[model samples]
Target chain A: MGLLVVFGQIYDPAINAAALAFDRALRADLPDGVIETVPTFRSVLVRFDPLEISCPRLEGHLQELLARQDWLQAEPDDAAQHWVLPCVYGGARGPDLGKVADLMGRREDQVVAAHAAVELRVAMLGFSPGLAYLGQLPEAWNLARRSTLTPEVPAGSVLVAVRQTVLPATPIPTGWHAIGQTPFRAFVPAHRRPFLLAPGDRLRFEPVAEPCYAAFDQADFLRKSGG
Target chain B: MSGLEILSIAANATIQDAGRPGFLRYGLSAGGAVDPYALAEGQALLGNAPDDAALEFAGAGGRFLARSDVWLATSGAEMTLTVNGDARPWRQSFGLRAGDELRLGPPQTGVYAYLHVAGGFQTEQVLGSRSTHLRAGLGTVPRPGIVLPFRADLPHSQQPLKLPRPGSFSRRCFRVLPAPQADLFSAETRQRFLAQEFRIGQMRDRMGMRLEVEGSAAFQAETGLSIASDATNLGDVQITGDGTPVVLLVERGSAGGYPRLVTVISADLAALAQVPSGELIRFQEISRDDAVVELRKYRREINTLKDLVQPVFRDPHQISGLSGMNLIGGVIRGDEEDNHDDD
Candidate 1:
């Protein structure tokens, strides 16, 4: 059995840890019939079959298991995969890159350097198949989404909205500012595991010539953690 | 090989099954039938496997020809179904031989309808699902000149099964379960959400339905939050920046940056899907416990209907043809001379 009433609103840090702990606890402690658990940026949705266990019993079980430990103290997932996505920053490839630089009062190259400097973590995965929501941008990198949405941002485009970098798996109508382009597909039907980025994975962008876009599909994406 | 050769299909028509679940972790929404109840009903009537694929008619019906002997069950919003130019009753199963022509008219009361074959369509599976994820560019879209493959082992029920047809417009209010972000809106906006009647905007599809507050000021979030995109589910009622409410459906994205105010209860999703564009809708809030109980009841009812299968004794076309006559049987059969659709 798990949490009885299965309804709670939470706002807390260590979201990644909580997601990991939640997944572990549900898998390790709970009885069968837990159909699916969708871990989001803030909360985890536990879908269950009432025919197997009543809500009250499930809630009671969940509460007892959760009371044993604080989620924030749980170990974070260590299986983050790294990839070097070749990106062309601050040009037609990124119509919004200059805007982001101007907004931060930094030169275009500095913005690109700062973006490439950090290995961003995938805080969440959603919005589309294989789309990764990466975050923890430095304070100086804070930027808002465009007031008007760009009707279509091509697939593999790097977009910045608020403090997160979103890699859309498909062409999408977006409010986020497109700051770069990549040939490294996060999702491809041709692959066995179509989605590339899982929650908690990490990635860093590598600068490349914009003309490489013509042969971008031939480029290798998965790179070593360092260099 | 048993197959369906599409003669004409509405833009919205597509092949669908229960859909690919467990993929949301990879940022894929469960893209399946918009009106799942309809899908289930068709399956039940034919005693087909639970995961078999069916045709989802999202527009004014579609026309097709049977390439082999096939049995089909119709469910969802009420619509005119005809085989070989004869009117047929909906929510029932009938036999079709090779070369039989079938056509479905636009819905009379709701937006979408479903056609279930005796042996579910054998379309290639992507990630273990026959359902189409239109946004993800997955699965087969039904159109003219396309052939959908299926197995032909199951026998079509001789007696057509009839379940109670839902009244299209009677129920406009749906049950809601407020999500964590419900409190983010101003109290006034929250009240207006349950009290005001919203019209389904033209921009409606499997992904979601944009709702506009009818007549009065459109509901807009007075304040906004820099919320990170998070996992979303079917039935999540999301509020856009402009305050427009979009009700997420089966094809909803795996996650969304917009704040979700509430989610329509699972039991009400079928009703929500049938709600056509421009229709007025209201919401009634309920506790999660109550919602769960209701959902269980709904599932139980559908499962029970599986055993209620019986026969629609006399053939529909046996009558004068136009008289859709069945289930309480009285209307005169349609005149065969009405050749406009006969061709």
Candidate 2:
């Protein structure tokens, strides 16, 4: 029974760096029975077949790889890219918009301005397919998640909670406040890559008029290989 | 044309295979057979390729009409199977000619039963799998009246099937590795987590299974701080805000907000899938090295299953036409047939 766990400080920059570094390195040249590698904000979960590589041997190999390279100094992968996405921030699209503004003690329009002003980093994708966890919302938007969970929210809903924003890839329940809706679909099953956003991409929100945003048919993007 | 015409079905019955892996980056959990070993067992019985597609039915499968000569095998979940109104043995390959009828009753134990045809089922694949990932809206769930196509052109299987080693379908304990957030729980809560037996909640599905806490106070987190949502895979146990721990499965969302307390290792996940609601479950923390060793042992056992298979001399007692069936026929396939259990 060999199951190995490597833990890291969640939200620690260096640990996050290590997770991505190890994840990339592992996928590039993996041993037989290395089932999967999941990189989180602070941990790298390595699932391997023990019959193929003993736990101690697998651990040694991982340690050797980490010790061999300075992951912190590793060059940023050029594959990472940035994109501008459109969103509708109020009315039916954003039921919690006024509440978010009230929580921040700002006018409704001012809240959208502040939210749209910053570039959000995609930290990780999980909880559903293609759902990217974008983080470090300016302190003004750092409202805690609701204690009560909503039974379901539609896909492409932009949520803010715990100083982070998430665009759910699938319609799912959430405790986070939905402040907006976007036409940008992160997941397209028929696409070659399927997920529009990855763990390392950057994105910014551009507020659009309700009519235009409403007319932003999500199905239209399906015809063009999803961007 | 040879196919299986479903007479009835539960809502969740779907075509499944080895699941879609290496696609988590696309925001999908690897949607595959809930009990992959069952698929392997059926595949082994048919001598089909490892990744061949099969039918995964939940409780209450409907009657089916086998059109043309069809070789079929079943695994996972304990059920009462009847061919032409006579009791049929499970976990063995059996043949049915055109118009023969087979009925499967509700599972006696467990929740998923895999139906594998000789050459495997025919279904459109999504992302390299025919599995139904309901959350991601991926493949089809075969229901009543559906004519499920199989590879009738492929050669028929004459191989015997192995009896599942006792305890394969009804085990309750699983080995787990502590998650990164394991230390967040108080020592007392951690103790209770291991000591208390958790019952499976009725809110079970492919995404995850909720555990009934039964007054256990395993609800303590070191910090009020929540981790940034991270990547979650099958078998991760996340403690929800209501203090219930939901053990995620193959159709889980890519990530979530709750603190994950522990994760089940891969080797034990298949058995866990078959565990029906109300079944008590116990978890033990094992060393990483030990877990790996256990997985190796499990893999070894799976690989050697072929040796356990031997051709069965079966019985025949019925004749069925497209219009109707006759069950009282006294014609037995052969005197030397293994119909000793048929009575």
The native-contact fractions of the candidates, in order shown, are 0.65, 0.64
Which parts of model 1 are misplaced by more than 4 Å?
Answer: A1-31, A61-66, A73-75, A90-92, A210-227, B153-161, B166-169, B186-189, B215-225, B315-343
What is candidate 1's lDDT per residue for B184-287, written digit by digit as tens?
77888788788988888889888888987756765665554466556676788998877788988888887776777888888887788788888888899998
What ranges in model 2 sit over 4 Å off?
A1-18, A25-33, A64-78, A210-227, B67-69, B155-165, B186-191, B213-216, B219-224, B260-262, B315-343
Tell me how each candidate scores on DockQ against the true complex: 0.45, 0.49
Residue B245's C-alpha lDDT in candidate 2? 89
Give a tens-digit lDDT track for model 1, residues A1-227.
11212222332337655765676567666576777766666656676777687777777777776787777676766755777788888678799988898899989899889998888877767777887777767878667667897888888899886667888888888999888988878887766667777766677899889678667753243434232
